[model samples]
Target: MSERGGPPQQPIIVRRVHRRGHGHHGGAWKVAYADFVTAMMAFFLVMWLIGVGTREQRAAISEYFRNPSLVPGNATLAPPGRMGPGGASDSAIKLGGAMDLPHGPGKDTRGAAAASVDGRTVEKEARRQEQARLQELMQQLRAAIQNSQALAPFKDQLLLDITPEGLRIQIVDKLNRPMFDLGSAQLKPYTADILRELAGFINRVPNRISISGHTDDAPYSSGNRYGNWELSADRANAARRALLDGGLQDAKIARVVGLAASVPFDKAHPGDPINRRISIIVMTRQAEAAALSQELADEDAAPPAATAGPAAASPAALPAASAAAAAAAPGVLVH
Candidate 1:
């Protein structure tokens, strides 16, 4: 037969047969897979517990894992009436059999409570003594202001009051006599003299000092970059610098705040010259403790999470606006 005329060539046929597993390779791999899955589940559960549990709860869980016998009877796994090892009652289970006595947890808790009470009492007594000392110091400061030749001229501008925080002294502006130059944060010669005298008396007290700057309701203009808040803060910082220059210790000033017009000396007259002033407060021990606690709390807080957009930016971080509107905002200047 001719090759071309040969019957249609048959298509090539290929067969592939996959082999099955050998009989000897039994279910060993299945067992291993099961074990791996169980281990993973247990790991995930432990991670979840650690992530969600509080400090005390985590400590308790860790103790239980270290020594299962240490788990209290109140736990779901343990019976209520059962006693722990080493003859400890169910009410008290000392870990690792450390305590041989049968005393309950209540005894230790009571002792701790008593100690706390005693500590509070001692703190109270110490605070009372400090208040008395600060009171005496306030009187001395008033007397010194009245008697001192340099401070006498400014006495009319200075007002003294005893507040809950401690002694509060306010220095206010007069119609013709301002503490600072117009539209500047520079301390005048007389203002410096008054602050210098104040620093000398303030040094005699152990309490910390707090300085604040205030302004009238009249608007201020400092380009768009500066506003009332910035101006007030600058004046306060300027006052702080003057106090430090006048023999006051750097550590003595606890806070320098700028209230702007929030706290007006003359409440009925927001635009009054007296509303533009500087305040110095000698903080009481209790107030100081509270302030320190708040500071620590603020410091220990976590940073805010970042977000996309200008909305995430803080007001303090945002770019300044036009000064046209800021001209109406209250501000401070130290001359």
Candidate 2:
């Protein structure tokens, strides 16, 4: 319909609408982030605790976490599925069993224990026992020698010692009773008695013996062709024979060596009275003549070419030299 001189006007309608500025602050994301951080921290703490704790400590920890109420003060709860602090499950405490404790210091609760001994220790103990026995025997021998009127005079000249080789008894020559006559290798009467008593003592021992003769650095007379070397050897052999006759077994005599004046007893005083002596050595199991002979034979049987190379060349060239040079070389022969 038309009104107030206007072309066909429609009816007007009014309505009010309010626009909200922004939604209320949503804290759900913040809560989720805080929960994630707390979970990560708890996981790391558990890992650290596990790494440092022993088996027993770990079992105790599992019990504590599963059921705080299962602790000593709070034992009224049920065995399993009981509430812990903050209402968590108590299943871990009921399921946990006793754990093995760690070993303390000095406790060897492992496998079968060892014997705590070896070959070297046994050998050392045996050697110690042998040495003690030998020392006791030496004391007895010394007492016997001191009590004998015939051996008392020779006590000062005798030396008894325990060496690496074994027991060594040396009889040194003095001015009053020389072990042998001036130039001859004959033993005196009293010397023979003393040797007989020594032989009696040696017969009791089950070890091998070595008789060695040494001389002072005194040159022989020109008229006498024989030198100290031959005299020493003869004297040593004579002593061996006398010992055998005096009840010492021949099988126990290992070797008879004559060093002449090469190995002096007192090096500072080469011609000392002690240098002229007869040394009776009891050989140890290791230093026996048999072992030395075996070692020597092995050395000798090694390739002759390896041992003879340099020594053979000089002998081969000596055949072309003068006869006088060859003769002067002792064992050399000239063509």
Candidate 3:
């Protein structure tokens, strides 16, 4: 095609496709920028975690991301002799932590552990609140003992403390002022008055009470059928009656027991007059439930059979370790 009359001189024309901006304002650049920001954020998050977390946490995190794989909780690309397609191993073949996430026996173990931890936390909080309430009750009783003119006279005998079971109020015997008549379960007039006074204060709480009577090492001469055990039991029952007469609810009495001389208040001096005492424990709800359970079991026509030999006999009959453990642990908690 000759345009200029000579051999083929083409017309010169320039066609320019103008770009608004040099790809800087395009969506692709925005996407790249977003990726950059995400990378920076992830980097900073990793750094923050490194600063805050423990060594174990860091190791676990590192292990979690060590090999980026499709399967979670499994890291192996291909286990030896168990290789699958694409020269890799399946989730079942991977040998690592979090056993069988997609499917297996221990898949729910972590969930169970988390649930257990939560349960423990809740239990701890409840226990703390209960302890605070019991402490407040103790303070109230102490203040009463301090302010009341009638109770101040026998303040030396009134011993109050907190046990895991509940708040224990022990009325000990002084050398000059014995709580009961000589060699008898009969309470003195003053002792009865004291118990009567305590009844109203204790009735303020809804908690049930456990009454336990203790004796000194002195042997009571009442024959084999009735000795210190019977005397202590009678004394505890007497105290219970006094409390009841003083306006305590009949249902408030959970248990009444006499320990004889088995658990002396003054272990250093077992024969001390203070060893002969009465312990009134205001039991917690949990403890009350346990007590009820035990009582129900005992009352059942066919109780669960314990080993015939050891638990039946005295702690003295057991091995040294067993005896020590028995002494340390709260057996039946209260009477």
Candidate 4:
């Protein structure tokens, strides 16, 4: 109510109140935050510079940090004498923009190149050793043919080849003269003789033997259960038996498989008689070692057999089998 109702008194104003503390005391925290940001930026800048330096430059920088007072390259006087290490700038340090990363263990370029060279050298040496071994084996076979007269009668039928597996001795079939019966695994008399003859000579070497039987693409005539695959396997086994009869050690046999028309001798003529044949592979030491990796651990590879006599081999490699094979399979039978 206005005094004595003269006028409507205005409501007493109470809109203002005092604040407790003036705004944020001063900006001390801002100065501290600015300093922290600046320090971080400087740190990252130094890291970037170090990251972009060359190997030698980085080394020099690291050395400088280790001993900042020491100067390089006889840089004794810089300002007073006006002398420097062959440059207008008194600094001996080279700040070339070499962005080479620091090398750690196993990261050296020279070491890697040397390792590659060593690998190539090893491969070449292995190749040379394999060739020497094959040549020695060939010489042994030639001497056997000349001296023993075992293969003289059927020399024309023999075919020799060098394959990645090793030396392959292919005994192919002729038109009228077949190694096995027309459609059976039964060996002809001549076939058995040839296998036996080959066995005796092959036995002299320390190498193991592999026999594979192949057949023509023609299907078998009879037997619902038996087929060409079975026949081929049986034929290979039969050959193995003949080899055993010819005094080849039982342990000399490595593998016997049947490949019925899979790897045909005459690809153009799948049904050719020559396709029906037996292959005797004298597996190289490398191949033999690879086989051992799948089956069992083998002995360390011996150096190639000594090149002494045509039929040179360890007398200890006699065909007693049980003990002799164990002794001979590891080392080359050097006479």
Between candidates 3 and 4, which one is better according to TM-score? 3
Error of 3 at 20 (Å): 27
Q: Backbone clashes per model, in order?
A: 7, 0, 0, 0
lDDT (C-alpha, whole model) for all candidates: 0.71, 0.67, 0.75, 0.68
**Which run of 10 residues does model 4 get worst, by summed lDDT?**
315-324
TM-score on alpha carbons, each prediction:
0.60, 0.53, 0.60, 0.51
Tens-place lDDT per residue, model 2, 1-335, is 66577788677877778866554466777988999999999999989979986554565556555544423322333324444344545344444332222234443211111112233446667777767766766787798779988788789888899876678788898866798888677888777778888888887767788887778888866464676767777788888888887888999997776666666677688777678888887766655744466546646865676664555533212212322443356422111
> Which 10-residue span in candidate 1 carries the lowest summed lDDT?
316-325
Residue by residue across 279-325, what tens digits does model 3's lDDT show? 99999888888877865664574334663544453322212232244
Task: Sort all candidates by lDDT, best to worst.
Answer: 3, 1, 4, 2
The TM-score between candidate 1 and the true structure equals 0.60
Instruction: Give me the overall lDDT of model 3.
Output: 0.75
Steric clash pairs (candidate 1): 180-335, 181-335, 185-334, 186-334, 186-335, 187-335, 188-335
Cα RMSD for candidate 1? 23.6
* TM-score between model 2 and native: 0.53
Evaluated at residue 232, the lDDT of candidate 4 is 78
lDDT of 1 at 271: 93
Predicted candidate 4 versus true structure: per-residue lDDT over 95-193, tens digit per residue: 354222223433333335445665666777777787677777777776665676657666656778777667778888988889988878889998898
| Backbone clashes, candidate 2 | 0
Residue 17, model 2: Cα distance from true site in angstroms: 99
lDDT of 1 by residue, 1-335 (tens): 45788777667999999989896689888988999999999999989978986554565555444443333333322334334433334455443534444336523332354456656667877988877887887788788878999887788898887777678888899989999876677889899888988898888888988887877878877667676656666788899988988999999998877666666677799899888898898888766776677657645763556744454533322212212222345331111
